[model samples]
Target: APDSPRALNGISLTIPDGQFLGIIGPNGSGKSTFGLCLSCLLRPSRGKIEVDGLDTSTPEKYWQIHKNVGMIFQNPDNQLVSTTVERELAFGLENLGFPSSEIQDRVDKALVQFDLTKYRKHAPHRLSGGQKQRLAIASVITMQPGLLICDEPTALLDPRSRAETLDLLYELHRGHNITVVYITQFPSEVLHMDRVIIMHRGAIVEDSNPRGVLSDIDLLERFNLDLPPTVKLADALRRRDVPLPAGIVEQEDLIQEMRDIPRGAPPGDHPESESARPDPTETVMELVDVDYTYSKDLPVSTPALHDVSMQITPGSFVGLVGSNGSGKSTLMQHLNGLLTPDSGRVLIEGEDLASKETDLTSIRQRVGLIFQFPEAQLFEETVFDDVAFGPRNLGMEGDELTDRVHDALQQVRLDPEYFSHRIPFNLSGGEKRRVAFAGILAMKPRYLVLDEPTAGLDAEGTHQIEDILTRFRDSGGTVLLVSHDMDLVATLADKVLVLD
Candidate 1:
């Protein structure tokens, strides 16, 4: 165990009471490790952590520490233990021996606060990605812990849900004076934090106020951290001799600053040119009048897709966007026959997926699906085994299999030598996501169906994914990307589809 890598190396820091702290870093950079240690979920190998004068190293203080600290993991599925949404919120309170009346009150308020009142009886696992993220936040805040540690909590959420979750956390911090340790890959989210710390290779590289840290674009780029779009634009403008004011992190600030700047004459309008469209007859994948429903014959039956029809041409990159529970994920499941439409046809390369003779396994091999939660797709003991599973099943063996695994890991920016034998279950959230992606990449599918592939990934990780997708597309691979980030979609998608 001593030979294993140290997630945190001689980290020494102290937090004041009722402070809102933000942590940012590249993938596998120990942000999650630091949060785990602070919450007492993980014990430091050598250094001691004290919470409210109580030593976390002391066995007797573990209960007190746990009672005072609540953590929302990067993956919501990991923490959800109850069958129903309401029960999930009450599970922690019930464990703490709260009264039934108070638990009910807290659960009711949390459901309403998270906009999950109508789905209180629904299973947590059945909720949409954004809904599940909301439930995870609600479950923790319901317990009303003195300290809260959130590790990439907004990664799975839609834009509106992200805004709501951040507002709720801010309210909890300002109104209740709850100490919040927020770890995220999004640089803009740290704008309002009292302090921000940048981590790299298990060490704190930068610790300062939000503006001080964010304004250092070179430092952030060096750490593979993403800059806010507004900040990047402002930096570019400043470099071009524009007198943009400092601290332009938010869109509003940039807009206000631009309003004060002198404007040149408006450019003459030109007619927009339409690009040549692909032939509908030549398609890689297509859905015809598709309809799907959950619990079709049961009392709680809910329709997911209705008359949905779309054609994805070969080597095309299509972006799917919608609100929470808007059937984006359900539609994706139909692509590889994971979920067959009740009354429609799914065709892959002119072959109907519903045909009895069509080989589903072969289709799946050609169309790799990356789940929203990376953990769901990872089951093997080690990263090497998981990534190799796909290629190995395709009859690859020996050096060929090893080469595929190593190349896939490298494609995702993971060092195969360092991570190959490492257990995936023990890796950081971002690392797990990358491993899952590498697994899909090793499969070398002709069509890649990704559901929020960039979710929970750092800036460098995101760019790596973008590069992989571009290369894949250029090599004649089709990509069906489901995402909530408009900028990502706009930058990568050849066409965009909106689902209701």
Candidate 2:
């Protein structure tokens, strides 16, 4: 372990006061480790991190340094220490020995600003992944840290929530003069930053303003970093001999570029467009006037869905887009029989899911639902056992069961021969996501639904999901995906359902 490569090598840098900085790179690039060092959570192996002339390694100055630089981790569930949302938000203030009145005031302000006031009394664990992420950010900002180091703080949020959070951070930097260091894998998130650092294999390779960092398309591709959607669109248009201007990275530029093209056939419709056409098959599943509400007895009971109806066609790819609390996740749960409607019925292949005689096991075997976090669904000791659990439930056994498990793992780009015997908990985040995907695919479900499938995935992991989704549709499987990635939706989905 001591001989392993360093996580942060020659990563010397400086951040001025009130600067909005962004750090991005591929997986295992030491971005998170750098943030930890800045906040004094981890001491640098060789160099040092200083916050406001205070060395992070100084033992006596540790508490003061931590107060000066607040950090919000990628996983909100891990950051929340209290049972209720309000308690969690107030924990940091209480630790700083703030007065009761001030703590209440700060907590109230955070609750309203983050749109979390309605669920202040709800358990943190009960909140959606996005909501939990919001709570984590709200909790840290209430501490009034001068330098806030965020590690993928908005990774689990919906598109609207993610944009709103970034906008809030920008306002905090401009108005409160807080130095913000934001770490993300999404290229578009850094477009507005005052400065951006590109990290690779634990080293800083590029340091420049937002335009300089995003304009170099070849550099990002060499490092396997993803291009922003608008950048990709501009590049593609340029390759078509349109010769559009360089440095185009916004949606408005693309709209203007399209307007100059004279609107021939509405774009994307060519003579050889049969392969790209969407042909819907017979209905596989349908929801009729569904209604659902959570915590009916509580004082803050909220309706999740209201008279929502939708149909899932066989072999068709569907994308569900929405903001947090817009019932996207709640609606996805109904498809797999995890939540039943209050008044309406769910039809699986024209058969009523509400019928007492219906078999849930058979339905679940035909429909697979992947949660936002893969760890929630992985419980078996070994990877092989975890993937085989679903198939075995359907009475599969012997060599037949093993083949299904192996093939599914291969579909997710995991070599079953090497990964089968490994412990599920020992796998990395990306590996765990692939394993979880394999577990559901092992069942050979006709329909698959995923919630934010690529929330924290890198470019490679994102490509793997895209390939799998395409192959699934080509083989007559139905996929309904909920995601914040508009680019992915445009590329994969034939039809889209907007929730809010």
Candidate closest to the true structure, highest TM-score: 2
Which tens-of-lDDT digit does each residue in 364-482 have in candidate 1?
98998988776677899999999999888878999999999999999878899999999999887667877888898898789999899888788766777798888888777899999
Candidate 1 regions exceeding 4 Å error are: 1-3, 239-241, 265-281, 373-376, 379-385, 396-435
Model 2 poorest 10 in a row by lDDT: 263-272
Give the per-residue lDDT digits (tens) of candidate 2, residues 23-51. Answer: 98987788998999998999987877788
Backbone clashes (count) for model 1: 0
Where does candidate 1 have its weakest 10-residue lDDT segment? 266-275
Segments of candidate 2 deviating more than 4 angstroms = 3-5, 250-272, 275-281, 379-381, 392-397, 423-426
Measured on C-alpha atoms, candidate 1 has an lDDT of: 0.89
